[model samples]
Target: MNAASPASPLLEVRGLRMHFPVSEGLLGRKVGDVKAVDGIDFTVRRGETLGLVGESGCGKTTTGRCVLRLEKPTAGQIIFDGVDIASLGGKQLQALRQRIQVIFQDPYSSLNPRMTIGQIIAEPMFVHGIEPNATKRMERVHELLTICGLNAGFADRYPHEMSGGQRQRVGIARALAMNPEFIVCDEPVSALDVSIQAQVVNLLEDLREKFGLTYLFIAHDLSVVRHLCQRVAVMYLGHIVEMADSDTLFDNPQHPYTRALLAAVPVPDPDVEQGREFRPVKGEVPSPMNPPSGCVFHPRCPMAVDRCSKEAPQPREIAPGHMVACSEVKITG
Candidate 1:
């Protein structure tokens, strides 16, 4: 695939919000909204991997879902290749699916038990009418299996017959089968064994380079994100609190939450790990249905001041391509 201009973004999300209505009683009267993703914005440059990292309920997955158009946003824009897809449906959305694909977190649940691996991978092609010929589809499946580091023979086996790592490789093959330009990897390796995680991550990295694919990689594992993504975005309570190049954000995190998250990552060396100051974030994440006023993180922020409780902070660029959303943090050139 030919790479798009390096400066042009393949995907751009602006003020994306997914607020699920909370209801009560059989009447199902809406009482409140669970703000899963609230007004977060970011861009994925063509052929670059952008990592979205946060706690389990911090809305990282929600953001990715909104981008995939699986959940309609309450209000915002999801631009894919310069077209707004947030409200698209029918044939248009179906057409968009051909260019964008997702590799889910759980390999066990994502694959079909009844379908053979060949059928599972070929299903997308069939739905999109990519390969109409039965022989050609099977041949394409074998090629994809080999590309994903699996033997072509595995195509005849069922999902129950493969190991977890092998199952995940099958999932990767399925995503690639679409010939997608962009992919959403929602913690693709999080369910695998630690040893297997590295292999899967490496495979994803290799595949991206080979195909010049763009990725919106949603993961909680900072180490994995650092290994695979060129840029990283840190989310807190439905908002992106910080973003920067992977190296810059990992080494010099500006937001309080970003700093705490990095601190929580365990160092492999005992001497370094033990010597490093480890302070867990003070409190549990607040409920998104009734998030705290002003900055949602103020309640848990150690550096929070009185103003942080009364005034929300918008993301401000402190340095080139490094944004931080904290009132207390000083901007440095």
Candidate 2:
């Protein structure tokens, strides 16, 4: 799949599906499948941060994994820089790893406790056949550590010796070691202290500008996504229900699901917040093994009609760049 054009998105996922089969019986015959990422589509433009936000188990993380080819999509096209990566194998796939990277959610378990910080960061460079010389690798490790706001001398320290925030910085350093053009930041700040979260977010923003990198920032924290992303895409039960620019989406959310999510956010002003309405999202998320027919969110959606429960809504542009998948949405200025 050649890139559609020079102005095409850096990463494009079309109809991506990842289904893990569930088997039961003496022979463990296939009985069901966990539809982790069920036919989702989105894109990340060059040098842009696209936020993927959703409740737990809504496939936000799974989508990120599919893009990185960590979890092979059962179906769909994962086009990176105009090449269809989902079909690549051997050296082709191996080479693609250097251009795309991931920073895991948990820093404690992500790094090897036995390895020193320098070795941890240099591992990717070595695997990619980059910075092969031992002396040069050490120098590059120090430079990456410094760039990620860690002390250069801490290269000799083990994972057990670092704080949570520090460990995350090392994780970031490792991801940067490959000099990737795109990164999957999978809740990179969720495990840190509130104060530390801000620092890490700021650092990511700075690094994006410095490296000219694009990011698929997956997180449940709306405020954090608002702070970091230029555009936001809301996922529900393996489908993107709404997508729009940060300011436009926040100010004028059209989908009922999107409205429900934004309504749950806490406002800072006591008096104004007290007067504002709060509509708790109704019903627990449905099981992905056998998700509801039609719109997955219709069961929990307050505004769902008979049609919503019978037919799936296709994405349609309501404004310049705002797209909503709910048929109930009425476009108005």
Candidate 3:
């Protein structure tokens, strides 16, 4: 794992919310909101990867999308490099896109099947008017392909012509084409095969070190998150239940949800796997459109009390750099 940077935050999300309006009828009248991302805050220090891990529909992807500005947020601020990008528009937003890039989850659909690998990687540079010379653009594309662990010859090939792993490498190359400072990797290796996942994850780690890149990595694979992220933020029903360094969160999880999540990850040792009891988190995830009162995870939280059903738990710093949103948890030295 990359060391956590002590540098100032490259990105800060404060009370960020993305509430999709639930509509009905031909007129599309709004009934309620699908609270994808409720009020939540976190930061990605320069050159550090912050993992956002949660169950499906917990708003991990939505939070990343809000950062990329793919979806306009319903509330809060996305402060990047000291500028609040939540309200940026026109040329300003367009310029910001160059600094922040995304590597999508699906390799098959994220790329243009019609374009060659070279064209795919070059498209971003072309749109942004980087490497204006045609020959230089092609050279840059070849260089990026090589940097992403693909053969330079692969540039002539189309998306359909390459394997799943190669396609994802192309996707990474495309993101790097913009020379971005921060990248939102939305499950970038989740779709690939197990062996391929390792290769891609290693590639990402190498690229981060080589280019000094910061990432907001969103994934459901706690194992991968533990390996790749320096710090982790656990989300549940649109709220961050826990946030801590990877080692601390995995080894000494305080929140009930976080403990359950770590418990769910299969241990590699056969003896331990057989001996350990598996206790999955009880209850299905609640609907975000109408979340329960008080703590969102109270229904499933083992440590929950009567007050948990009435008062929402604000995130409290229990130790230096470790935050938990549970009334039952105590501060530690």
Write the residue-wise lDDT of candidate 3 on 1-333 in tens digits: 244455889999999999999999999999999999999999999999999999999999999999999888989999998889998898999999999999999999999989999999999999999889989999999999999999999989999999999999999999999999999999999999999999999999999999999999999999999999999999999999999999999999999999988898888899999998998888899999999999999888888899999999999999999999999999996
**Cand. 2 Cα-lDDT:** 0.91
Clashes of each: 0, 1, 0
lDDT value, residue 17 of candidate 2: 92
Listed in order, each prediction's TM-score against the native is 0.98, 0.96, 0.97
Q: What lDDT tens digits, residue by residue, belong to model 2 across residues 147-264? A: 9999999999999999999999999999999999999999999999999999999999999999988999999999999989999999998889999999888889899888999999
lDDT of 1 by residue, 173-265 (tens): 999999999999999999999999999999999999999899999999899999899999999999999999999999999999999889988
Per-candidate Cα lDDT values, in order, are 0.94, 0.91, 0.94
Which regions in candidate 1 have their CA more than 4 angstroms from the true location? 1-4
Q: List the residue pairs that clash in candidate 2.
A: 3-82
- Badly placed stretches (over 4 Å) of model 3 are 1-6
Question: Model 1: how far is 313 from its true place, Å?
Answer: 0.1
